[model samples]
Target: MNNAAQYDTVIVGGGPAGLTAALALTRYRHRTLVAESPAAPRNAASRGVHGMIGLEGATPAEVRARAWAELDAYGLTERRDTTADDIAPAPEGGFRTMLGDGTQVWSRTVLLATGVIDIHPDVEGFAACWGRTVIHCPFCIGWENADRTWGLVADDADYAAMAATGFRAWSADVIAIAPPGMDRAEETQRALRAAGSDLVQGEITRLHHHDGDLYAVEMADGTLIDRQTLLWAPPQRQVPLVTRLTDTLGLALDDDGFVTVGADQQTSIPGLYAAGDLTTAWEQGAMNAAGAGARAADAVHFAHPA
Candidate 1:
C-alpha cells in the first residue's frame, strides 16, 4: 500500500496485452506501473501460443516470462499480487484507481488489458482434462492434435459449423456431436459429410478420463465414444474485473460485452484504453497483444504529447 509511487500510466492485469502495453509505454520513457493478480484463472487451453512470430511455439508462461524479462531490462515497474478495485476520473484529466490492498495510484491514463474467461461445460471430468486432451480453438491446438481422432462437443448448430472449418485442416475424422433434433444447415452438413466427419447425435452426460488423459465420452444412453482429443467451444464471458472497471468509469461496451475501442484502442471514455481479447473477437496470442498494445500506447502518446 505505497501511495507514494505514482505513474504516468497504470495498467491493470499483466497478461500479454498489459505486459506489452507496459513495455511500449516504458520504452517511450513514460512512467508506467503494472498491477498483476497472481496466476489463478485458466487461460487458453494450449501448451503453447500459436501464430506469434519469433516465439511461435512458446507456452503462455514462457511468453510472459520472456516479455517480463525484457520489460525488466527496460526498468519497468511491476507490482504482483495486486488488483484494481475501482477507477474514477481524476479532476486533473486522468484517473484515480484504488487497489485491493487499499493503495491508490493516480495516473495520467489507464489501460484495461483485463482479459476474459471461458465457461466450460458442466460435464463430469471435463475440467480435469482441459488444457491437455480437452481443448478449444483449433488454430491454437489443432496442429498439435492433428491427424488424431478428434470430437467436436458443441451444444449449438452454428458452433458446429464454425468448428468444422477450423478442424478441417487438422483431421479428416472430425465428428460433430450434438443433441437429438438439432438440425444443422445444409452447408454445414455438406461440409461435415464432405470432410468425412460423422454427425453424432446424443446427449453427453459425462466425460471419462484416466490420469489426466481423456479416454472417452459417455452419452445418456450409455454409449461410450472413445477419442484421443476432445475439442469444444466454451461460452466466453468477459472477466469481471474489466466489466466492473468499465462500468465504474462509464466506458462503452459492445453487444457481446467486449469493450468498444477505436482503431487506436482508445475506448469511449477519454484517457482510458483497452486491447487484446477485451476489445476484439478474433483469436489472439502474443503477437496480437503486442500489436494492439503498441497502437494504444501510440494513441496515448499522441493525446498526451510532452
Candidate 2:
C-alpha cells in the first residue's frame, strides 16, 4: 500500500460526526481519510439545521461544504466520495477498509459515524415528503410550521399523547393518530382532549401530496385529515455498513441495534469506535453528532498518539 493510502484514522460516513472527527484528527496532524458515500444524507431534504448556535438554519449541504473545505485546509485529512464496502482488523495491526470503488486503505483506528436510516412507514407520499414536509424532529421543524395542521403518528399512546399536547405550543390544531388495536391510556386521552387535540384511531392509509408538497393524510376509515406538516416518529436502524462491521469485527450492539460504546466512544473492539446516531437513541441531531465526533476524535487521538 502507498504511504498516502495509510492513515492514522479512517472515518466512515461524511456526515457531521465523521467530518468533525476528521477536522479534529487532522488538526492534531494525524493522517485521516474520510470515506463518504455519495448517497443522500438523512437530513438532505430538510431546509436547515436547527438549535445549533452560529449554524442555525444552515442546510446540510452547506455544513458539509464548509466542513470539507476546512479539512482540506489542514492538508492532513483526505475525503473519498465512496462507501466503505467492508472492514476487518489487519493481522499486522490496525484495520483495513475496502472502498466501494475497489480501493483498500489501512488505518490505525476506525470510527463509524455512518448514522441511521429512518424506517419510514410505507404510506403513499410519505417517503416523497420526508424532510420536506414530513419530519421527525419537532425542534427541527416545529418553529417554521407553527400553528399549521400537525399530525403525530405513533404506536405508543403515551408518546402520541405527549406529542399531541406538547405540539399545541406549536399549533393548536394538533392531531394524534394511534395505530389500530392500541388503546389510548386514560391520562393520554385526557391530555389530548384538554389540549383540544383530536385523537384519531386508525392506520394511516396514505399521505396526500401534490407537486411534491404535502397537503393531507388519509386514514384507513377514509377520513381525510387536512395536514400540511406531519410529525412522523418512525423507528430508525443503523446503516448497513455498521451492521456488517458489528458482525465481522465482533463489535457489541445495544438491543435496539445501535453500536454500544463507552463514554470515550470506543466500541467493544479495540482500535474501533462509534459515534453519532448509530451510538445513541436520543438526541439525534447534526450538532449533537458533531460533538460526539469531536469526543470520539479525542479518544482516537489519545489511543494512537505520535
Candidate 3:
C-alpha cells in the first residue's frame, strides 16, 4: 500500500467555506490540505455578489481570487485542484481520503465544505438568467434592481404569498406565478392583491431574455409579462461526494436533505465537520458559509489541541 500523506485537516472544497476554514486553521498554525474539484464553481453565472460586507458587488471570480490571495499570506495550507473521490474513517483514527488523481491522504479531521447543487426548474431559458436576474436570494441581488418589476416563481400558495408580499421591500411591482394544483390559491391571490401585489396562476412557458439579461416571462399561451428580476428558490441537493457518502459514512441529514451538524459544525460522524449550503439553506450565502467555516475551524482546533 502506498504511504498516505497526513495533515491536520482535509477540506473537500475550495470555495468560500473551504477557503475560509483554511484561513481559520492556518491562523492556528495547523497544517491543512484543501482539495477543490476541477469543475467550475456554482456561482459562475453571477453578475455580482451583494449583501456581503466588503465584498459587495464583487463577481464570483473576484471573490474567489480575493479569498485565494488571502490564503497566500498564511503559507500554511496545501491546495490541490482535485476532487476527493472517496472518504471514510481510517482504521487507526481520523479519516482517509482519496483524491481524484488517486493520491491518498490521511487527516486528523475532515471538513466537508462541498456545497449544494441548485436544481433549476424546467422553464426554457431559465438557466440563461440564473445567478444573474433569476436569483434565489433577494438580499444578495435586489439592491441594484430595486423598484423594478420583479417575479416570484412560487411553488406553493403560502410560499408564494409570503415571498411576494415580502418582496415589496425591494420593488413596488411584484408578481407571484403559482403553477396549477397550488393549495389555497384563491386565498393567496386575495392576500397578495390586498397587499398591493399581484399573483398569476399556471406555469411559465419560458424566460424572456437577451443574452441572459432577463426582461420578461412567457406564459403557456405565449403571453409575456415584463419582469426585470425573478426570485425563485429552487430545490437543492448535496454534491455528489456528500450524497454518495451519506450512507457510507453514516452522516445525518436533515429533513430537507441537508447534512445536520452540531453547534460547532461537527457532523454526526466524529472528526467529520461540514459547513455552508450543505448544512442548511437558511441564510445560504458565501458570507454565511464563511462564518460557518470559521466556527468549524475553531471546533476542530480545540478538539485536537496540543
Best by lDDT: 3
lDDT of 3 by residue, 123-210 (tens): 8989888877888888777786687788888877777887555877888888898888889988888888888887888779899899
The TM-scores of all predictions, comma-separated, are 0.89, 0.93, 0.96
Extract clashing residue pairs from model 3. Answer: none
Ranking by TM-score: 3, 2, 1
With a 3 Å backbone cut-off (N, CA, C), the pairs that clash in candidate 2 are: none
> lDDT for each of the candidates?
0.77, 0.84, 0.87
Write model 2 residue lDDT over 1-306, tens digit each, in one string: 444278899999998899988888888889998999998888787889888788888998998898888888879888888999988888778999989988999999999999999887778888888886787887778788787788887678877876555776788787777876676555566778787776777788898988557798898889998988888868988788788877777789989788899999999999998889999877788888999999999989998983
Question: Mind sharing the TM-score for model 3?
Answer: 0.96
- Clash count per candidate: 0, 0, 0
Instruction: Quote the lDDT for 243 in model 3.
Output: 83
Q: Which stretches of candidate 1 lie over 4 Å from their true place?
A: 1-4, 44-46, 162-166, 180-191
- List RMSD in Å for every model shown: 2.7, 1.9, 1.5
Model 3 bad stretches (over 4 Å): none
Write candidate 1's Cα lDDT for 130-240 as tens digits.
Answer: 877887666767787788788987766777765456666887676778777776645566777776666678888888889658778899999999887888766777776
